[model samples]
Target: MRLHEYQAKSVFADAGIPTPDATLASSVDEVVEAAEDIGYPVAVKAQVHVGGRGKAGGIKLAESRDEAEQVADEILGMDLKGYHVDRVLVEEAVDFVNELYVGVTMDRGEGKPVAMVSTKGGVDIESVAEETPDAIAREHIDPAFGMHPYQARKVVYDAGVPRELARDVASVLQTMYQLWDDRDASEVEINPLMVTDDDEIIAADAVMNIDDDALFRQQELAEMEEETFEDDLERKASEYGFDYVRLSGNVGIIGNGAGLVMTTLDLVDYYGGEPANFLDIGGGAKAERVANALDMVFSDENVDAVVFNIFGGITRGDEVAKGINSALEQFDEIPKPVVVRLAGTNAEEGREILNDELVTVEETLEDAVQRTVEYSEEEAQ
Candidate 1:
């Protein structure tokens, strides 16, 4: 549910936040046209979902239309963190005296939306936090009360910005908060909220991530989703009604609950193995669902081994076992080794059913995780 920079900037502009004039281009001709329209010294940025675009040669400064076209052609097909850049944001360059950071995000631990601000901006906020924690200021805003003007004013003032820009910054923060709260956003960030030489403030870069659960309320945003670069395994899982998130590990996890899925992934990591995905089959682990989940995991070439930690409280373990057996019969071959730990109701019968298979069955979660990691590592060597 992450919006591209241009999409986020459009939202900010609609909310009355001052942002730079920019145009999105998908081709060299479009980039040249956009740069010519915006004039010389424009910034060409790749439109990708992942970060570190600057470090990955995805961001470049073009002093002329020719340069813009050259950079755009080079960046449009380049991959940034596995996501191919299909477009570039051509924005007019501005002369700024200082840069600052402002963002509002959900703090699950605090159960509130936290407003974060810092004088140091245009860089990874996490690195700033780890190196200079004191430079960043954070305030938790109660969801019930929302962000007040006085609270935002205090943040701007505390950040050591000039008095002339405080009110403007406060206004931007208020508008951003409105967009965040009204649209059910997971994060809204304006990096390098620049203070221009003319004493004007503008958001140089914007990012917004909408809550996937709340997409039901945002038809327009949902329609804006572009799935051109989604992982193949994830798309397949979605087609089969399972919630899947692909990760970069060898051990594939399948479980009944989200909590269990996450715990299984952590265990894999703890046991010195990476999780291939977080695949949750929901509470009802019917034969179809289990088979679909296993099919999705086995399709992944990176998966060296599979781990099924099914604690069937509501879902019967025997049903899950049957699904696995059915999937093995359906597919010509299961690509990787599998480790199963079926506990809770009907566990003994499920264990007995899988005993005849080549899969490893462990008594404990730790044992299952250790065995999967060992098997994957051995296969790798």
Candidate 2:
């Protein structure tokens, strides 16, 4: 899961990493209050999930209380990369003599964590890799041994960090690595890590994405996940005990397993249909969970039709059928069509239970996909 800048910086501070003193504001009055408290020359940053906030005018410098309020009014409720900004982080605007980039991320190829450093900061790091690969220094860190202090210093020095600030930067890198490991983070980045004229180092901008699979162990981080998922559908799905991923398509997909859900997506594309989402209800789902899954998928405005594909080994088809009936009955009216394909344990009984005019029941996956596509096409007309 991705974290907003303020949330990521909170994690950084929790790990003992220094960051600019900041306050969260939800209103213009709050922004001015924070700015006044933090002193003049504060930065008002939109707390959205996407990057390029600065380029999109989601970030502004306020040298006074009035400017802070004005900037706050402009940023709050403004759309950044399709996400509405509900809050802003009012931070102390400091003068930095130098800026650097440091991050710890998973190296999927090597199956280990890697620490990266670059002199270039406040810009896209991928662009730096593409334009000038030589400027970035990367060191692979073994999970067993952890990141050594010497290894951290070597990366910063190779990136040409000045001798006076090398140790401080190195310390920050180690703390970042520790945070990544301790939090089970997939990635942790400090962009434009700045050194003030006084030679003090601090993280000016932070980005972090934690591994979803590791959330069970990181309860605090899991609780904090609510801050990022503002969409009602996404929030509801999390409340339910299932996995859901949004997609750009007309056909909403609900399947029993991850593998089946993925294959269903490929087949939908092959059959000239787009999938609106990937929802896995998991094994042995009951009527309530099934109802919850359907409710979540139907909440997406883009979904024109829904496909329920279940191969019941541990999950009985009858249970799924009951769930579908319950959901459809609860709603006074359903504008979209539903295609259900059931196999394995009590499939016949399940199909018998769901003999409704609104639901299209299919005997095979191919038939279900074709019917779903046709229904979506019909809905478009």
Question: What lDDT is obtained when candidate 1 is compared to the true structure?
Answer: 0.85
- Pairs that collide in candidate 1 are 249-274
Q: Please provide, for model 2 over 310-363, each residue's C-alpha lDDT reduced to its tens digit, 9 standing for 90 to 100.
A: 998999999999999999988778768999999999898899999577599999
The lDDT, on a scale of 0 to 1, for candidate 2 is 0.90
The TM-score obtained by model 1 is 0.81
Q: How many steric overlaps does candidate 1 have?
A: 1
